[model samples]
Target: MVKTARPRGRPPKDADPAPMEDVLQAALHSFATHGFNGVSVRTLNRELGVSHNLLHQRYGSKEGIWRTAVDWGFGQLTEKLSAADDESAPPLDRLRTFIRTFIHVSAEHPELLRLMNIEGGEPSDRLDYISERFIEPQMARFQQIWDELAKRGETKDVPQEVMYFMITSGGGAMFASRALTERLFTSRPLEPEHYAAYADQFTDLIMGALKD
Candidate 1:
């Protein structure tokens, strides 16, 4: 009988940008479909169409991939927010722009939000990295905008955290309740009109909350 040799150690770290992105995309899909608990290296490798070595080489583990996926999602959000020409508009306009963009991006990339919710509960290194890098920067930018609006008397004197949650909750609800909405309402995917109605209501809610 032939004897098998001892197993080697872990593969080299993934350093290529393209393959890294591919793996990230697969992880995002897994998280969206099954939530955090549902993803695994075997499934990820299968979905990515890469070898187990390749997956491990790139992300180390499922947790690492989840972290990177969350970061990528937040990065996409930052890009969407930045691309809007209405950044200089009034606070309410800014809020509207963000809501519309948020819905558009979320509809396009539901996996990202699902991954975000999955990684949110774990106190892992990737979570800390995302919190420090992506979330903090975004919050600071929002706070500056809020301060500007406050000065202009467009916004009430509310704590920054409260404002952040209020804005985030709109997006969160749409994402979190998406399945429920789809099940109870029409089966057709969200259209511009659907998002528009939601955005309008969200904007009105924010305005009402801030009005003196």
Candidate 2:
């Protein structure tokens, strides 16, 4: 053997690298709290404890990082929605499942709603990109499901866009208004149990209202 040349320049570090998901999650939180124009690569690197060069190397630019972060956040929601839509159940059950799932996802990832709200507050390329890449597709899918339910006589004949807005905005309110939610419910914490109970009640309320 040639002694392996001492494995090149130096020994491997014992520290494990951060996963892409973790990076994206951190970016999501940062970008959601501070809009794209408000955040800097250096700030993100400092918060993440990584080099600024890493963000540039991986995403090429701040815009690229914003795009990736938005994609990652919405990708998670899309996966959950797709799974709920695919479940082999009655139309009404599927509708309820979708509503509950949406609320649960919003509660679990409040950053998603925050980021969306921030983007929606101002007109920019970032907002347009997110709308085109994530929001439109998600809305289309939900519209298809809603239309199916209506055709099956399971749900009321409501416009797709109206129902979509009702479900997303209404279900996301608890998560999107953290300060208000905490202040209003000062006696108790907004724990997972609270979210679960809310999801159940919200699903019932929406489904009841959507009945023919």
Candidate 3:
């Protein structure tokens, strides 16, 4: 009897356990670029050089990966916002810190904004999940801060929802509109200094408007 050789090309399944964080990062980028329906397990597997079985095992399904990716992205933003909003600081200072931190994070992770834009343009379960899990909670926290400022008469009476929308959508545009920003500033590439300057200007503009 002749002994048959085992498969040479594919390694044993246990040989390479998937690095979950790396998978999430890749999934985040893919979902951000392609939205929910545009991405597939096969595509992700090919891109990450992992098996579809691994992704399924880790996330359960494509929707699971989408949910996880959205959670991961917003989790990062929430942490940054929480750190920036120091309760020990004065309200205005805390507000400034929050705005600057938000702009900085937006610049660093433009993919977050892109993904949100894509989700906002469509009506789907993925969008509903993001709204419940991320958007509503963050907006509530922001409204709480504004309410405190209003009680102290530091800020004028403005619609909290409008202000929240302006802060996120307007600030996001600075980083999201890369082509327009680059064309507008043809002499220089957008760097850290540019983002810093924009943050300062954005804070000043919002503060001024709120006071007025």
Pick by TM-score: which candidate is best? 2
Q: Tens digits of per-residue lDDT for model 3 on 51-120?
A: 6588888788998988888788888988888877878888788788878888778877777888889898
- Candidate 1, residues 1-212: lDDT per residue as tens digits? 99998658854343333466676777777776787677788877766555667766766777777777877767887787778736667776775566566656665566655555666777866568767977787677666677777788876798877766566655555555677767777545354456656656666677677775
Per-residue lDDT of candidate 2, residues 1-212 (tens digit)? 56655565644322334578988999999998888878999998877777657888889998888889888899888888888785567767777887899998998898888887888888888888888987898777666677778778877787777877688877887777888978897625457778888888888999898883
**Candidate 3 deviant stretches above 4 angstroms:** 1-18, 183-189
Candidates 1 and 3 compared: the better one by lDDT is 3
Overall lDDT per candidate, in order of appearance: 0.67, 0.81, 0.81
TM-score, candidate 3, is: 0.83
Candidate 1: 10-residue stretch with minimal lDDT: 10-19
Model 1 residue pairs with clashes: none
State residue 45's C-alpha deviation in candidate 3, in Å.
1.2
Cand. 1 Cα-lDDT: 0.67
Q: How many residue pairs clash in each candidate?
A: 0, 0, 0
Select the stronger candidate by lDDT from 1 and 2.
2
Question: What residue runs in model 2 are displaced by over 4 Å at the alpha carbon?
Answer: 1-17, 187-189
For every model shown, what is its TM-score relative to the native structure?
Answer: 0.71, 0.84, 0.83
